[model samples]
Target: MSRAEPKTRPSDPRFSSGPAAKRPGWSAKSLELPSLGRSHRAPLARGRIAHAIELTRTLLEIPADYRIAIVPGSDTGAVEMAMWSLLGPRGVDVLAWEHFGGLWIKDIVDQLRLEDVRVLVGAGDIRHRLTMVDWQRDVVFTWNGTATGTCVPGADWIEYDRQGLAICDATSAIFGEPIPVSKLDVIAFSWQKCLGGEAAHGVLVLSPKAVERLLSYTPPWPMPKLFRMKDSAGLLPGLFSGNTINTVSLLCVEDAIDSMEWAISIGGLSALHQRVRDNYQVVADWVAASPWADFLEAVEPCRSRTSVCLRISDPKIAGLDVAGQHRFTSEIAQRLDNMGAAFDISGFRTAPPSLRIWCGPTVETNNLKALMPWLDWAFAEQELHLHQHS
Candidate 1:
């Protein structure tokens, strides 16, 4: 028998991993006070920028010595800037377990064409490979595998006295995971991620060591004006404050401030982390109960609490070949979408067939519980549809 559709729907269904679900009650009216038309150099506009950085530091409990700047582009821009400026000083090690990680490796090898670079990969057991790497080489990696839903268990894997810099692309892990700032040299994330702020700009947090490296070493390659962080005098200190290298949408800035304010009100990072923990627990409980569903990342410690990807192992879906599996997975996601039970829960375009649900802080645990029944209904309906059509 086909299962009946779920009667209760999630109150808010904006669950795309990037530009994720907005804070509860977020609306366009939140931008009313922004310095929209004013010059960013003006005191009012600059103060807004400074406030955003400061609140983010407070919420994230960032160390005082670290510099946080609003940079051009999103997380990609911040990561690339760090790579372009700090990589050539020594040999670099790039690590990958998913799509974003692969892109950084390509940048180091294909784009920069760096001779002394090593790429380590595996969706599971990457920590073992990381243990074997020469820490003397500058290392680049993502804090979370957004596509694969795996993350480094913790910063304990890092060598405390390593000579080279650790540049991490922490776009998805920033608010959702605990990152040891003392161990990371350079970390970058966008406001549009777990915070659920608007996109088109990013925040780059640089440790004092990273700043020192930027000031002392200049890359041999041509640095575009957008990527350059230094001048003849050395690292541009102004950028670390409120001065931006390029124009940003003040509307987005206001939205970021609004989100940061919301974060602080909810007891800051601890509250946010608890919210995500609760959200993930709801799905984890469901997955434990459902014989047909399993996590894409089997390693519990490495699983991402933010982008939760799952594979269907039920005989109905698992027996299908790769192409058939893809179709079946898409059908399930589409059915859920058409029913207004979920949105953007499809796995990444490049990843294997699965469902990638956003379990970030912005999402309420109750909503996830509500959505789970819809997921079960969708899968059943999809199987029935396949049977009738075929």
Candidate 2:
């Protein structure tokens, strides 16, 4: 039997994980461009960058003692900077739950070749291994797995008075979820993720401990100019004060500021969290009734609200081999994209076959509610086609 076209389509179809949907009512005209052509070092441009940093601090509720800097590379660059600058000082415990976390592990073992490293790995749910990690060693993990949509419930598992650092890659979780800033030593995220701003830039937040590590220890490997955060005279004075290590896009700065301002106007962090919660609930409810799909993260607490990844549950699709599953899911995603009901909702290239939806604050709950039916429609359509051909 053929499933009918969805009676309603999502008002806006963008659902990409990164470079995700823009904030509601967002437009290019909404961005302030006075600093567009100006040099990054210019007063106007520098001021905008500084404002963006401050806005990030305010919205995310980062502690005053923590320093925030706008770095050259997006979240990837920021995480690399942290690992390069601090990991040599002590043994580290790294988690390899998803794409980015796995990469961090590779960097720690293969690239850095760190001798004393403990890698704790898991698939959809990694909570059990949390108890296995020794807090005495520096810990590297993603607060939320962007690819798998699994997240640690909270920071309570972290040792408050541990001897080592807690470095986190929180690109997709920053504004979209609540983060405990005090427990983290090095936190990295990109403007393009939760803020729905443009790419090519990352925000690095450092606890006082992270700064002390930077000032005290230097990695044995060469540090690139882009990753260098300090100099001979203590830390770089201007680096955190909007004096970026390299040239930055002034236009992107304005866009980040615009997003932050929008976030602030809409009741700040709590409001953003509420928006994410509501949006996730809409998808969760749909999945609860979905005969063919369910979230990859089975544990409710561990499931990420921002990146909601769903796996196919239908017998025909689930029984397929890895490559077959990939091809099937990719085809469905392409069909949805072509139908103009959704776009970029496919699973991460490195992840298992699944549908990853962005339920960040920028994405509207109404749109997600509308999108649920379309998802069912697409899945059923694919099933019908399979039945006829096979």
TM-score of 2: 0.98
lDDT tens readout by residue for model 1, 193-221: 89998888989999998988888887889
Best by lDDT: 2
Q: How badly does each model clash, as a count of residue pairs? A: 0, 0
Off by over 4 Å in 1: none
**Residue-level lDDT tens digits of model 2 in 193-282:** 888889999999999988888988878898888888888888887999899999998888898999999999999999999999999999
Instruction: Give model 1's TM-score versus the native structure.
Output: 0.97
The candidate scoring highest on TM-score is 2
Ten-residue region with minimum lDDT total, candidate 2: 122-131
Off by over 4 Å in 2: none
- lDDT scores of the candidates, listed in order: 0.88, 0.90
lDDT for predicted candidate 1 compared with the true structure: 0.88
lDDT of 1 at 76: 95
lDDT of 2: 0.90
